[model samples]
Target: MSREIVAGVDGSPESLAAADWAAREARRRRLPLRLVHAWRWEPLEIPLEQDRPSQERTADDVLRKAESTIAERHPGLPLTAEVLQDTPVAALLSTEERAEMLVIGSRGYGAVAGFLLGSYGQQIIAGAHRPVVAVRSRDGAGGGDPEGGVVVVGQLGSADDGAPALGFAFETAAARGASVRAVRAWSLPPLYAYSPTSSALARADEAGGLVPYEEQALREALAPWRERFPEVRVTEHVEIGSAGQVLLGSSGDARLLVVGRRARRGVIGSRIGSVAHAALHLAPCPVVVVPHE
Candidate 1:
């Protein structure tokens, strides 16, 4: 099958931005883009006086409108649209068997006032079968911009598991002619556990030792990348906090946040790692969750 990118739409500005991002990605890769609009008639029944034309209140109409908007705003892109009579999360999951990547807006029209993202966006990222790209409002697509092409690849403690992530990151960075900021985060156990003589009195020493070790870990992770892509500019960040937060905090200037999805059945399972799950919802920019298989 041809490469396919599926993006959710809800008539919100955030969703529109997602459509734009997905369209640019699809065009870049020469892949077909599938625009999805999932809607349902909740409460099943409406008061006779409140009921309007079924065409005006149906999911199909909403989807058609979205398709028209896309045609207007994103012309000359290979695209298709679908309106599903189901929840947004379920609708996206239904297309998992064939989609190369599933994209969704951070929030929708149904989102609560003053909230940046809705619950559906979070749920889909944590449980998607394929890679899930959570497109944030701040991620606007424009050509010839001098923005960073940095992509953060979240490692789940294994070099082999991180291969696809690094590959994707490197290619994206290369395409944009920007540097790759490879980051790794780890937390160390208390020094007292390793040394009976070590105590709070040696707190300064304990802190000093951790810096080198963190740097070494990050260096080892990027060793192969440096050898393989000597032409690509690579910067390493060794963080000492939650992986999700550090990655999210740095994503503001990133072109994309690449993460590995963990699975149990085959080479990859249906579940995404905890850190990848969190970053999808809270990332300052677009996040791409790469499946192991």
Candidate 2:
């Protein structure tokens, strides 16, 4: 029942890149790494003649290669691998139930190549109960700056609402000896756009009043976190714009981008907010979606 970091791999370069990132993260957290591959034979009508073995062999080979790669890069790191006989999304979601976090590649081959967020990745992110990180391939697309990079987290709610994300960001940054940049985005109320008096008041608020208040709120939200993680250097960023746009802009130089996902419960099904959605699809660095109550 001990918690460990789980990563999904399918023998693709992108998946391997994710594994690499996951391995480093595991090392940072001082936890074991588990690499999982979900596989199922195709053409069910063809009969199980050697096809099953071929599929099994492919999955084994992929797992072994990933294990070897992680060992080479991170010596003495605790590592394990598994081949699950189920669909990718189902397998990963099941893994999430017992994992501290689930890491996966941003894109894979075939129809998912060009898309920033592959269909399977999107599904897993939307459904995972735990934090999910999407890592880009190392060749040219995924991974963070080789040099140390900052940890950027998006904050849009009260301290209670954003506490989990802020804590995660601070922990991640502290582990990496990196700085934490907490960004808060705000705008005028809807009524301000229609009423002249409201508009003027909003303009006046923006001119000198709103920014300090926003910045103060962000500082207050992070105050306890800063105290808890005194080793971590923190920066408060307040901007006037869409939450998604502001987070995306800050992600370019970030080692990891953390965002909060409000937990939803109902028959209508759960949904990731627009800002988290944008981060998943457009972030240049790895994006971690942390579900908050």
Worst 10 residues of 1 by lDDT: 108-117
Supply the global lDDT for candidate 1: 0.69
Q: Which candidate is the best by TM-score?
A: 2
All models: lDDT?
A: 0.69, 0.81
Could you give candidate 2's per-residue lDDT for residues 1-293 as a string of tens digits?
78899999988878888898888788888999999999876665654556668778988998898888878877999999998888999998888756989999876232223227778987788788899888878522333434356999998868898988898898889888899999999886565365556744555466676677678778889999999999988887899999998887766777788999987755776777798887777776778999888
Candidate 2: Cα lDDT at 129:
83
Model 2 deviation from native, Cα RMSD in Å = 4.2
- Give the residue spans of candidate 1 off by over 4 A: 40-58, 108-115, 141-148, 190-231, 264-274, 291-293
Candidate 1's residue-wise lDDT over 1-293, tens digit each? 67788888887767877777777777666678888888665554645544435744675666677677767766888789987768888988888876878888775222112125567875686567677777755564343123456666665455676777777777666655668877777677755566646552255365577667566656766778778877779887778788877776666667678877765554543455677766665665677877675
Give the poorly placed runs of model 2, Cα more than 4 Å off: 41-43, 46-50, 108-115, 139-147, 192-208
**Highest lDDT scorer:** 2
Q: Per-prediction TM-score, please?
A: 0.74, 0.86
